[model samples]
Target: MKVTWVWSIAALALVAAACGGGADIEVADAWGRPSPSVAANGAFYMVITNNTDSADHLVAASSPACAVAELHESMMNDGVMGMAPVGPAGIEIPANSQTTLKVGGLHVMCIDKQAEFVAGDTFSVTLEFENAGTVDVEAEIKEG
Candidate 1:
């Protein structure tokens, strides 16, 4: 009986080890606009740090705060400002590197705002990744 119990414990430990002992990729300080203050649209920004020694990409994103969520980039086209969708070829996070989505840069544009996000309010957003799967994060609404 003692032998059986010891083997069971060892098996459990092995299983835990195989499952990485609950280790997961870390995300920090994720926040964004809950809704546009004056317009029907808004944008969100966050910093994503890839702790693992592997390359990853932000494939997709979604939020209940808006009718549509899309990855966008603001750029200058012959002195004209333009924004466009970044499709399946998503934002890349190099191994051991960090990427920041900020104003006038790569960001998630929330279109057709559904709810207003005031400062101190939190909203849920799901980010899809190539390897880490879907990570649901809360964004704190703040002044842009």
Candidate 2:
């Protein structure tokens, strides 16, 4: 009887978590462009989808290949497009919505790349969220 009661409680907790829907995040279409060996920096792109009722923020990003990885944005200034690091608040992921990290927009800035981003190669990047915890994803090297 005690074992049955414990199992019942555990099942209830699982159901509650799924139905509550708090900070459930998923990453898809993660890819990075080819960077020459001499290049100092590279970028990664992906679609971050939030599948819950509560919103969350992507606080940071890191990888073994980059000395520094940061959330960055590209915007137009004086009729020319420039790239800069994102603010301290990081990137907002609205509830039940998705954000795209693409060229000419928000992306993961891989600074001082430790290795070449060659085509057909793969690397790992870890994304840290304010509430959803950390997600490890493989980034495929490709050309646009």
Against the true structure, candidate 1 has what lDDT?
0.80
For candidate 1, the TM-score is 0.76
Q: What is the C-alpha lDDT of each candidate?
A: 0.80, 0.92
What is the TM-score (0 to 1) of candidate 2? Answer: 0.83
- lDDT of model 2, residue 89: 85
Worst 10 residues of 2 by lDDT: 16-25
Model 2 local distance difference test score: 0.92
| Model 2, span 16-110: residue lDDT tens | 87875454898988999998979999999999998878888998999998999999999999999998888898999998899999999999999
* RMSD to native, candidate 1: 7.3
lDDT of 1 by residue, 2-75 (tens): 99999999999889767653324545677775454567887888888776689899988899987998999898
How many clashing residue pairs are found in candidate 1? 0
